[model samples]
Target: MATMNRQHHLRGVLLASVACILWGISGVAASSLFMLNPHITALWLTQVRMISAGMILLVFGQFAGVKPFAIWRQRATALRVVSYGLLGLVPVQLCYFEAVKFGNAPIATIIQYLGPFIISIYFLLFKHVTPTRPEALGMIMAFFGTLLIVTHGHLNSLAISPVVLFWGGLSAIGVATNTLLPRPLLPKFGAVSVTGWGLLVAGICLNVFGPVWQDHVTLTGAELALILVIIILGTVIPFLMFAHALGYILPTTASLLDAFEPLAATVFSVAFLNVQLTNYDLFGGMLIILAVMALSLNGRKMINFLRSFRTE
Candidate 1:
């Protein structure tokens, strides 16, 4: 039993790592689309990604003899799907695009990763559960680490717009909400089905809001190819992998592993974009990695200890 559990945990970690790696590649992929207008690029990429990913998952679900829409008739299930699709998936992507437009990609990535610590706050306020000491310490370290990366190790250099920050924060909240909202429905409908539906709904919403019928739209061969690759490898595959992993791991544990996205992005940028890596970047990256490790390993124990001490 012990060996089985350990194997499961290792598999979950590997799947989560793959998801982060794909997500990291997205940054480098997206940078290539910058020759076109960012808004158009973002809108087109969003549509292609969600639509393609959703369709592929739906097909895969069918092949696996799984009914992806088994719970669509249930009112609660419908509500959960819409809520997750709109408030979680749609807003996170839109807000992230906006953040990248107003700020740097590295900065936006770092800010979005603040989702996990923000989730700890959400549980504390709503669930009336506080984090363990180690978890809290991890969160503190991550917060500073994020700040270090975003400010480029110069706190005085901070000049982000309030609107950008607000949207970025909203994106972070969307991530937290997504992390928590799928638990009950995931078991009933299956993670792949749920994620597929969410992506489909979110894609429709994005189209409704930013209708692609505008005359200014133009797609070059290179852009179209990039968009296709983004849809397949970046969005579809990673999301499926994430859903599969989520089935085997706790939500908080999954979220902690997502902290690797920024680290992966940093590495991707350094390699593909030929971005210079400094000592500060290395230090901040190490802090973020350690913080995630600490949180994943000792979060629950630390929380219990804190609760017991408080009660005593």
Candidate 2:
């Protein structure tokens, strides 16, 4: 029994690692597509990715006996799907891709990783929750890391464009929504089912603005392949693994393990895309990763503290 449990634990870690690797690599792939076609808007990519990946996940879930469409059968679940789709999924994709469009994937990813800090701050200010030592340390690390990344260790001048920073910061908040907003729905339906329906609904909502059909962008073979990677590796696989990992491991452990994502993304960007990072980038990114580790490992303690505060 011990050996079997150990094997399962190892398998979960491996799957989570592979999922993060795929996510990190897929961001570079998306960056390549954006580089090839400067005219290809982020909106187009979001629409295509959400719609295609969304359907694939839903259908795949059905085969796995997931019944993704079960959400539509419940009024509350159906409403949650719409809310998650529009506010949670759509904004995150739009902002993350737009950040990638403006900047390289590595920095954008590191910036997005600041989501947990944002959440911690919110709980501190609005929820009247005091952070424990770990949470406080995490918040400080995240803040300094973001500052270093943005200013490139030069607190006086900005390293990247202000426009890119705007989108990246927004995407970080979007990450918070993506993580926290789905909690209620996750208990009612499996993560896969809720995620699929959310993605589908998000795609539909995005399409209301203007369909990609209205675009003049042309897709080459390379572009088509990259899109497939983004849909499958980036969107579908990561979600599936991260969600599945929760079943076998603590969410905090899973979150700590996901630090590999930014590392992988950085390596891929430097190796394949010839994107170079400064010393500041590496150090700042490391600090942010430490923050992530702190946040994940200490999340429950912080939550308990928050509940105590509320009761008192």
Candidate 3:
């Protein structure tokens, strides 16, 4: 049993790592889309992402013997799906776009990473579950590292526009809620089914509110092709991997691993966008990587340490 648990954890970690890698690449992809227009890019990407991911997952759910519509009959399940769609999927993308509009992609990505720390606080205060010492340290390290990256080591330049900061903070909250909301439903309904339904509902919401269809969208062949790639590789595949991994991992663990997305974005930017990598970026990335490693390998020890300190 011990060996089996270890193997399971290893697999989950691998899956989460891959998800972060794909998410990191998405920054590069989104930057490419900026060549067209930011609003159009945001609208189309959200529409394509939600719709394509929804359809793919729905097909998968059906193959797995889960009917997507059947979930709607259960009001609670339907509500949960809607909550995931509206509160989870929509806000993350929208706020991210808004943040990027006011700030650079790297800065926006770093601010959005505030999600894990938000989750940590939520768990610590509301759930009354003190994180272990290692986890607490990891959280602190990750937070500072992300801040350093966002502020570009200057720390004084951290004063972003108010609107951008607000949206970025909201994006973090959205991620925290999304990560926490699925726990109760995962056991009753499979993660795939829940994710599929939520995505479908969210896709519909995006379409309804999105400006792409409103403008009677037309796309260049290149743009259309890129959109399809974003939908398939960027949105659908990553979310499926996420759902699968979430089934085998703790939410906190999953969120901690997600910190790698920004680091991955940094690498992708350096490679494709001609973004310079300074010593600060390297140092910050190393700290975030170490923090994630500590959380993954020694979470329980960290949690215990925090608990003891709190009690003392």
- The number of residue pairs in model 2 that clash at the backbone is 0
Q: For model 1, how does the per-residue alpha-carbon lDDT over 92-186 read when each residue is reduced to its tens digit?
A: 67677566555545556666766766767876886677688888898889877766655666777754566667767777787777766665676
Better of 1 and 2 by lDDT: 2
lDDT tens per residue, model 3, 1-312: 999998998888889889877876766666666665544556566766777678888898888887666777888777877898788877777677666555545656766766756766876787677777887898889777766665766767854466777877888787777766665666667777777767667767776665446655567786676666667776778777877787778865886787678877777777777766666656766776677667666656435544454343
Q: What is the lDDT of candidate 1?
A: 0.71
How well does each candidate superpose onto the true structure, as a TM-score?
0.83, 0.94, 0.80
Clashing pairs in 3: 131-303, 132-302, 132-303, 132-304, 133-302, 133-303, 134-302
lDDT, each prediction: 0.71, 0.84, 0.70
Q: Backbone clashes per model, in order?
A: 2, 0, 7
Off by over 4 Å in 1: 1-12, 36-39, 150-164, 246-259, 276-282, 299-312
* Top candidate when judged by lDDT against the true structure: 2
Worst 10 residues of 3 by lDDT: 303-312
Q: Write candidate 2's Cα lDDT for 154-217 as tens digits.
A: 7889999897898888888887777667767776678888888888889878877887688778
Estimate candidate 3's alpha-carbon lDDT, on a 0 to 1 scale.
0.70
Candidate 1 vs candidate 3: which has greater lDDT? 1
Q: For model 2, state the Cα shift of residue 294 in Å.
A: 1.2
**Poorly placed runs, candidate 3 (over 4 Å):** 1-14, 100-106, 153-156, 159-164, 207-211, 245-260, 298-312
lDDT of 2: 0.84
